[model samples]
Target: MARFQTPLRYPGGKQRLAPFITEILEHNDAVGWGYAEPYAGGAGIAIELLLGGTVDHIYLNDSSRHIYAFWKAILTDTEAFCRRVSRASLTLDSWQKHREVVRHPGDHDILDLGFSTFFLNRCNRSGILTAGVIGGLNQVGRWRIDARFPRNELIKRIETIATKKRRITVTNLDAEAFMRDRVNKLPPSTLTYCDPPYYARAKRLYLNVYTPDDHVRLAKFIQSKLRRAWLVSYDSHAAISELYRKRRQFQYSIQYSAIQAYEGTECFIFSDSLKIPRDSALPYIAQALRQPA
Candidate 1:
């Protein structure tokens, strides 16, 4: 089916980062790498790559069990899960009904049930993982099912299906573990798009206790392991800006809001410690980096 039939409703999702992703992929002619997004949420980027046929292999991961479960269901029981989703009326009453329909079915993996539960997640007033579980817990807690199905233009797009032939793997792992441990197991040419938790806003929703130190560690890790792998990261603090600036990397600044609060600039870095691909135009910030600051 279409790599994704629904738009994910998470703060700082790579939905807006799609354009930059295309640019970077195009610039590097990075159309054949094994794609990995350890922080996969809503599978936005992974699905995009699937549709564009950018990568021959895909690996998606999200620490959030709710998200991981949703993916499991879609991949394994696509038709049945879609049927359940389509039959359910998109009202609050229907929400409970659908929840009950899929709730106790042990034939499928809990991850599958979790994937089927995201329909309500996108519209929940709090926009957190509170719904679709038993007792409302934070990201760590179980999910409770509630909320309406997708509607309007976006949902219509999601209903379209496209088949993918590439090998695809999904998991629930911390981003660094996937990069540090998993990358070594892959072929020499693989691409890792890390939409890690935003350093500024939306950090709490992403990780139980993400701190500034985590961001520094992540950057250091990326730089160290980037010799053979290509990576794309979105971060915009001065420290982030300065860290890569020192490495002679290209960084693009874009503005977007998170959690309905508009603030800060998101800086995207294009790095592949390999020789810069010479085919495409230089990245936007390449020339800017040549100049002072």
Candidate 2:
């Protein structure tokens, strides 16, 4: 049987890269180690690792309050969370209502906030929370509204995740703060996977934009934990490439169909302690340890 899919459709989710991620985790001996995902967007790869028994425990963290609230509800009250999402109506009206509340959810109840996040994410085109409308004005009917929002499938997925016996800790904190507060306390056996927003598209794709300086800060923090951390980002930015010039890097292309089909280069930066086996699924690119002249 196929591994349970992520309940939400995240724009940059690594669902297709699950096999390669599993291969990398296996290569680095992740079976008994704790797995930490600081930027856990849709958490597709993390869920896969947990379900495949690749890790002993998983720590999921996200800076987005709504996203974090949704995950927190899932971990604390899976049935109620699933019920809230399952019963949500997938209509333009419903989408707008939820979007309004998610935009300012300070006064909303926890379950409402969770449902709002879940609705906006799944109902919005391309799973972009900020993108308004269930289907963009020009792209109405492009998404089979009812068919795409499969309540039963989502509930099943949530149930599967909820039943996993392995420990799961969900936190709402800035990535750096989370690392400082929790990561330092964990054993070196912990393997952290950082999938921050792409530097070039952060402002367009995410609410909390990662500026060049933020990228530098993240790089510095990851460098401190390089012995057990792995970072992924688009290979288009020069500053990012320069930041990890001395580290081991792997480049691969990810192809997906949105409004149109597109393929882009993705880079994985890792410490010298991690090795990419020759037999791994990713098409190996030369290690990126030198800056472009």
Candidate 3:
């Protein structure tokens, strides 16, 4: 099956981990259930599941107001959003202008905010607004615009994502609160997939960073959901291990960098009720390690 492309690029996205997630969902018969993502950066896994017909409904939430605004804009007025994004130029000056708007949105309309977020994310380095100019441009260097930011392709992607508006529920809320509001109300077959900011690099990479205390709170929240099946993806860290030590854990290596062969060990902590096959998790480590930078 062809993969559904995400409208925005995100750091630590779960594209590579979708296979294992699919396996887990299939094994637990959770594919028919409504899906929820409390920290849906780019909504990679959620979109994958929706496209694959693994899930009928999805509830996507993000803590960042900018991201939430972008999502809302897309789902509400896809044509206008895509039109604005299509007109965005790939230039340093344009990037700077959009960056200004994103940094201090002030009274700007949602379309402006959404387009600014989209342009800055697509043109900026590593899809990070604060990361400055786009990196890894080969001989062209940072100043030169890369062809990767294709206009028509992006519009097409936006249209494709817009088609699923009826099946998705986008919200702007804190992860814990979002969970508390929906965990009990969702069907018994429902599954929650969480890809929160990693404890080790949360502060450095994300605007809405989570602290050690937040991790503790998340651990407790997941533990409290006794009837719902949930899965969390996070980097392997001592603090994280200790917090989720009681849950079933599976480790896999992921290559997050396209310009460099950067790899990190991430753990998938599953609720007690869920089961992940050994074969689904082990082979990916070798494949990720062997991938070219």
Candidate 4:
């Protein structure tokens, strides 16, 4: 019997407390259910679901092409990816080379280049391999990855996970389109875990903007479609609450300190509608929410 230990390669990934996400699954007995993620930034939750054997199949979607390519590479290529990352120097010139490869990488080396680029992106400062511009506190505003980062270990872990590729599906599309299609395509046992883009007042490089209206539309869409599913993770503003106000669900604000920005208690929203049985853990969810900030 094999196990999964590799963490998701993103800045705000929930690897630190995968238990919170896992608790939701364990309580619901969600294993073997179809796991769908609308915003598959690093596939952190999705990968955890896969490794936990909670989901027989996964449907992952992200609006970013670069992210999608990275997923594909990890699933299909490991050794070449390691070599590329090992050879990539994190200087300004090397970063530009990475960006170029990301922009127009040919099919001959899709898997290796994709994974290498994504690895460098995460290993780099700010978790983006865009440019060498350093800014902000905690270096949240720079792209830096030393050549000595653990590229070999990443390759080994990715290779191990790639062996179980029969049960995963990856897509690059907007969050709404993936949900719309799933409504008509999937069975009733599927579960969705949404961690939408943050709605805070800040600026960063993202593929697109998910406005307050977008959040409302997605919440409504999730409620109307899936017969037996739950949405977990952060919500943007009060838009998610307003969308789910009609339906009774447990909502919580988890305080998390961002390592990149040294910011504390960035209130993240968790909206869930899993008809949980009378259990001991449910009260704590509310208790944590009500405790003064």
By lDDT, the best candidate is: 3
Query: Clash pairs of candidate 3?
Result: none
Q: Write the per-residue lDDT of candidate 4 for residues 1-293, one digit (tens) a residue.
A: 32335424455665544455566667777657787887877776677667777678877788776777777777666566657656755455655566667666564265645654674565554565443323322334333345325556656667766877778787888877877776347887777777777665323534455777776677677677645465645533465555666654444544443334543233333335564433334354546545553
C-alpha lDDT (0 to 100) for residue 130 of candidate 3: 70
**Model 1 lDDT tens row, 42-155:** 667777766666767778887765676776655665565556555545455655543553445454466445644565555343345433332232323343333334344343
* Model 2 lDDT at residue 273: 71
Clashes of 1: 14
Residue 130, model 3: Cα distance from true site in angstroms: 1.0
Q: In each prediction, how many residue pairs overlap at the backbone (N, C-alpha, C within less than 3 A)? A: 14, 0, 0, 3
TM-scores, all candidates, are 0.72, 0.89, 0.90, 0.76
Residue pair clashes in candidate 4:
31-54, 32-54, 125-144
Question: How many angstroms is residue 201 displaced in model 1 relative to the true structure, after the best TM-score fit?
Answer: 0.8
Candidate 2 lDDT, 1-293, residue by residue in tens: 44547787876678676777677777776666888888988888888888878777889999888888887777777888887767777666777788888989797876778878888777776777887555464446655445457787888888888887347888888988888888767888887888888877657567787778888988887887545556565646678888989886656666764434577667877766777655655443322323232
Candidate 2 C-alpha RMSD relative to the actual structure = 3.1
Task: State in Å the error of residue 14, model 3.
Answer: 0.8
The models' CA-based lDDT, in order, is 0.58, 0.74, 0.77, 0.60
For candidate 1, give the lDDT of residue 202: 53
The Cα error of candidate 1 at residue 184, in Å, is: 2.2
Residue ranges of candidate 3 with Cα displaced over 4 Å: 1-4, 135-143, 225-227, 258-260, 285-293
